[model samples]
Target: MEEFNINSVQVILWKTMENLIEDDFKKFKNHLKVMKDVPLSKLEKADRDDTVELIVQTYTEEFAGKTVVNILKQMNLNQMANDLQEKVLKIELQPMLEKQKAFEDARRAYEQREEQIKTQAKYAEKQINKGYKKFDQALQDEVAAKIAALREEEEQKSQMMKEKIEKMNREISALSDTMRAIEEKMRSDDVTPPQF
Candidate 1:
């Protein structure tokens, strides 16, 4: 059997209890004592909500609802009891039913949101990976260009050095020829000595 909500029924009873004058309230409290004995001093101090709570405590929710209704009818509050009895079914089912409905609605909304996030995340991941790949390719191109430029500069240096070596060899050859000519002239002068 489904456990109907007790608090809603308790509130209904409390509302009915509110209509009672002081004497009637006292009568109602006395009637509650007949149902279940507690300290009268405790009952005296208790207000409408407290009285309903006490009844619900003494008897469970179902028994308490019936008990309050019978007590009201006994007190010549038949119209109020009739009105309340009609509300009893509504109050018990409505709040709990609405709560279940709300829970189901929330569950559906959450599932839809989860799917939306998953779809969006996939698109985002693909775009980001493409961007990173492009960036990596750019870096590779830049590194390769720099390496080729440095190699070309080194080749130019080697070519310049070879040209300089050839020029130095020509200058050494011209000096050697001049030294031979001077030696030949000195020998001719020595052989011809005569007057200075």
Candidate 2:
């Protein structure tokens, strides 16, 4: 037997117990009415006895004092408790979600800073390498220029020394020729060589 029937379901009935039970005979009559309305077509013939028994029990308990009312009150309180638990879970999760978001933001910020630092370091390294290359090139050019200048000065000095040597040889040759001429003249005249 079905403990509750969907066919006879009433949205308003759950709102008030008085609608289901008023006095003793009225309760009994309501139970019979609901029992007849219960679809026998859906029920197996074997379940008939059980269905009858359940209807009778429900009617008796509902019309009697205290117990059914207490049960209804307990169900309402249980509903309230479930609602409170859901609210608390939502409240607790809100802060946890916020904290998770904060942690994610902080992690992202740290990663960005790390990337920035890496970029700066790379740039600095590149600049240093550039400076070193430039310095190395400058030093090489300066040494090469000095070597070239020294070679040029050495060639100039060699040329000047050659010129000085040629001039001195010419002067010595002229002086030798003049002495020969004077000696010939003195011999032709047959004059005694004057003691100077």
Question: Which of the numbered candidates is closest to the native, going by highest lDDT?
Answer: 1
TM-score of each: 0.44, 0.41
Clashing pairs counted in every model: 0, 0
Positional deviation of 172 in candidate 1, in angstroms?
A: 3.7
Residue 7, model 2: lDDT of 18
Model 1: C-alpha RMSD to truth? 11.0
User: Residues 63-161, candidate 1, lDDT per residue (tens digit)?
Assistant: 677787788888887887788888886766786789999999999999999999999999999999999999999999999899889889888988888
Question: What is the Å distance of residue 27 in model 2 from its true position?
Answer: 26
Residue pairs with colliding backbones in model 1 are: none
Cα lDDT of model 2 by residue, 81-179, tens digit: 343344434443555787899999999999999999999999999999999999999999999999999999999998998899888888878886777
RMSD of each: 11.0, 15.3
